[model samples]
Target: MSETTSFGDWLRPALPLLLLRLLIDEPGHGYGLVEKLRAAGISARGTTVYPHLSKLQDAGYITSHWQTPETGPA
Candidate 1:
């Protein structure tokens, strides 16, 4: 992004909302979420995304469960 931080300055405030909207449209695990953000050119790194997701979950804005992939370790 234009900034030196993990995520862009423009997206800092709205990151949580964007993440919620993405989950609402299509639920995914952490890596997938990171991929989606990268696909959209949001410049979100795991270090940035995971903490937000955790906060969202902690605040009851979202929830998650473990799901093993067919070809990968859980």
Candidate 2:
């Protein structure tokens, strides 16, 4: 649909900002971040999010590491 496409376009520029906010949020990670954006109606994918993440990292706004999810919460 054009609306979804346009909305996605409109949202594309904001991915980095949103991603930063999500990182400040609890339990943030690769798939969870994507899912949250999708849930918020962004139609986010790696092509979009990964670049912004890389940019944010390059700018020293965030970092990444391997998170091993536990079977249960601590």
Candidate 3:
């Protein structure tokens, strides 16, 4: 594969791990995860991050909810 494609190949697998690691710091909503990914230098878009979040929720690695009064970023 070309260099760019190879990089993307690696990134695809790493995204879930990235999301999990971010949540390890605390819990986050969809948008929060997107920002954390960006801030972590992961260049993730919502399209990618949200679906992963859903999968993570289904897999029991993470959870979610509406922004509550005491909810904070992860």
- Please, what is the whole-model Cα lDDT of each candidate in the order they appear? 0.85, 0.80, 0.79
Q: Which is the leading candidate under TM-score?
A: 1
Better of 1 and 2 by TM-score: 1
Using lDDT, give the best candidate's number: 1
lDDT of 1 by residue, 29-64 (tens): 777888998899887888888999999999999998
Error (Å) of candidate 3 at residue 69 is 6.1
Candidate 1: which stretches are off by over 4 Å?
A: 1-7
lDDT of 3 by residue, 1-74 (tens): 65456656777789999888878878777788888778867777899888887898899977677654655652
Please, what is the TM-score per model? 0.80, 0.71, 0.73
**Models sorted by TM-score, best on top:** 1, 3, 2
Give the Cα RMSD of candidate 1.
4.3
Q: Write the per-residue lDDT of candidate 2 for residues 1-74, one digit (tens) a residue.
A: 35345666767787788998888867476677899988987788977788888889899999777656686542
With a 3 Å backbone cut-off (N, CA, C), the pairs that clash in candidate 3 are: none
- Quality of model 1 by C-alpha lDDT: 0.85
